[model samples]
Target: MIRGLYTAASGLVAEMARTDVISNNLANVNTSGFKKDRAIFRAFPEMNIHRIGDPAVLSPKDKIDPKPFIGVLGTGSMLDEINTNFSQGSIKNTSNPLDLALTGEGFFEVQTPGGVRYTRDGSFTRNQQGYLVTGDGHYVLGLNGPIQLPDGKDISINRRGEVFSDGSFVDRLLVAAFADQRQLLKEGDNLYVSNQQPLPSNSEVIQGALEGSNVNPISEMVDLITAFRAYEASQRVVKANDDTLGKAVNDIARL
Candidate 1:
């Protein structure tokens, strides 16, 4: 009875973790360059079931017979890990020169207070200092350093990440990629950080466009409902075990 209670409780905890991931995905459905996270589950080890007080173990004649095997009992399940889906998001045209979108696998390098962070968000603007920066005011890095645009100059970014101002070549955008995308960890502000060395990206940079989040609201809603139902089922199992234990301790003890 106690084992059942613990098993059900483990299930509840796993379902709650899954619910959190799904809720986050739903909330970031419209966030630019946002990726969705999936919760993976692992089952606890199975317990072998043996018949108690078997007659084969006691009697000499029955000693020749094999012990009876009942079956295996499942303990419960647990949350394994959260994985990010790095699929490309839909692109939307904004007709703004600073707005960029990647057509392939890559990330725009940004210089943050912590260190160099990478992001897919292309919604960029020129700061008061005439330096190109992300929406969070982080400096957008170029091939050499932070990209700066001269005041009152027309700007354009080509497919190869080259910046042109007033029909003059200025600097190239620092686009990067990772060999193992799983190593990249989210550091908030739609940015990812990884210890692995970055590779030069061959991805095309589409100017005047922005990438939307890849989260599908309908699928996330379905997952949300499924997790809620599973949580409720585990809660009921815990309650049932409590009632069974109460009867065995109080009601049966009275007799």
Candidate 2:
């Protein structure tokens, strides 16, 4: 009964973790370039149950009875990891000259206060110094370095991510990618950090647009309900175990 209680409690804890992931996804439903997280779970190793009792029940000097395997008993479950879905999000046309959207796999490289970081958010603008930067003022990087746009009323970006101001070529946008995308880690502010160096991406850029978040609200709501129900079931199991333990002490012990 005690082991069963612990198993049920483990399930309850796993469900709580799942709920937290779902809640975060729902909150970021409207966030630009946001990706939803998935909660992975794993079960503890199972123990083999025998019909004749444990083989260690007898001393080494004494003869032991044969122990036939009956079944396997699960210990508990736990939340393993939270994996981010890197699939592309839907695009929205902002019609702003500085706005950009990626049609395939890629991220924009920006020089932040904490060194370099990558992001899918393309809501960029020109700073007072005429340097292309993110909404947070991080300098957008080019092939050479931080791009410094020339002063011009006409600013344009092509499908190849090349920038042109006043009909004069300036520089190309630094769309970066990694060999192993799974190595990328979220660094908040819609930014990501990777241990590997950035590589050339095949993504095509679309000016005057931005990518929306990839969160699916309806699916997340359904998962939330399922997690709540599972938690309730685990809670009931824990309560039942506690009640049985109480009866064993208060009633069964007296008998």
Candidate 3:
């Protein structure tokens, strides 16, 4: 009975973790260049019912007589990992010269307060210094360093991610990729830092657009409902176990 209670409790915890991931995904559904995360679970090691807490059960009854094997019973499960989904999101055209997006696999490099960071958010603007920067003022790194746009000039970027003004090449945007994308750690506000994988230089960039979040609202809503149901079921099991324990101690013991 105690083991059963623990099993149910584990399930509840796992469901809670699942719910958290789903909620985060739903909240970021409209965030540009946002990638959804997923929760992974692994079952606990099984317990042998016949040999549980009994050393005497290990002895063979007879050499010829077969002792039927009892199947292993599950203890429970838990959240093993939370993995980021790197799949590309849909693109939205902003018609702004500063706004950019990646058509293929890549990330735009930025000089954040914490140092160099990576992001998919391409909503950029020219700062007072004529430097191309994110909406939050992070400098956008380019092949020649921070890109500086000429005042009142029509800017255009090609599929190759090169910025041109008055048909003259100004600078090329930096699009980076990771060999092991999973090693990247989230640093909040959609920025990522990666030390496990070196940045790859082959990714292409697209200008005049921004990548939408990869979150799927319908799927997340369904998962949220499932997590809630699982949590409720676990709550019921815990309550039932408590009631049973109470009855054994109070009512039955008194009788």
Candidate 4:
């Protein structure tokens, strides 16, 4: 009964974790450049079951025999990992010059207080210092360095990420792509950090637009329902085991 309780509790934990991921995805459905996370589960190792002859039924002179293999007993399961889905989201025109979007796999490098980080969000605005910055005020890095743009008027950014003012050249945007984005870890605020070296990006930038979040509300809602049902099932199993254990401790012990 104790083992059953533990096993059933593991299911509850796994389902709770899955629910957390689903809720997070749903919450970020309208967030720009947001990526959804996927929860993966793994089953515990199975134990082989075999039949053993009753010792009391065997004679002292006769050796006990082992019966044929019965089956396998499952212990439990757990949440293995939560992998972030980096699929591209739809780009929408915002009509703001600082707004940008990536058409392919790439990230915009920015200089933050916590060092440097990468993000797919291009909803940028100029800071008080006339430097192009993200919504969070992180400096938008350029090939030269932090891009300090001229006055807001007559500014244009090309698909090649080249900045121009009155047809005059300005610093190019620092668009970076990682060799393996799986190594990147989310650091919150729609930014990712990685130790891997960046590669030249083939992605094109679209100015006056922003990327939408990749989360699907309907799919996430379905998953949330499934997780809740799994959690309820586990709860029932736990209650059943508890009742059995109580019966064993009270009635069976008195027998």
> What TM-score would each prediction reach against the true structure?
0.96, 0.91, 0.89, 0.94
Of 1 and 3, the candidate ahead on lDDT is 1
**lDDT by residue (tens digit), candidate 3, 198-241:** 46666566677889999999999999999999899989998999
- Worst 10-residue lDDT window for candidate 4 reads 54-63
The lDDT per prediction is 0.94, 0.92, 0.86, 0.91
**Which scores higher on TM-score, 3 or 4?**
4
Which pairs clash (backbone N, Cα, C closer than 3 Å) in model 2? none
lDDT of 3: 0.86
Candidate 1 lDDT, 1-255, residue by residue in tens = 999999999999999999999999999998888989999999999999877655555565556334567899999999888899999999999999999999788999999999999999999999999999999999999987999998898998999999999999889999999999988999988999999999999899999999899999999999999999999999999999999999999999999
What residue pairs are clashing in model 4? none
Residue 218 C-alpha lDDT in model 1: 99
Error of 2 at 129 (Å): 2.6
lDDT of 2 by residue, 62-87 (tens): 75557867799999999999899999
Order of all candidates by lDDT, from best down to worst? 1, 2, 4, 3
Model 3 RMSD vs true structure: 3.3
Query: How close is each model in CA RMSD to the real structure?
Result: 1.5, 3.4, 3.3, 2.3
Number of backbone clashes in candidate 1 = 0
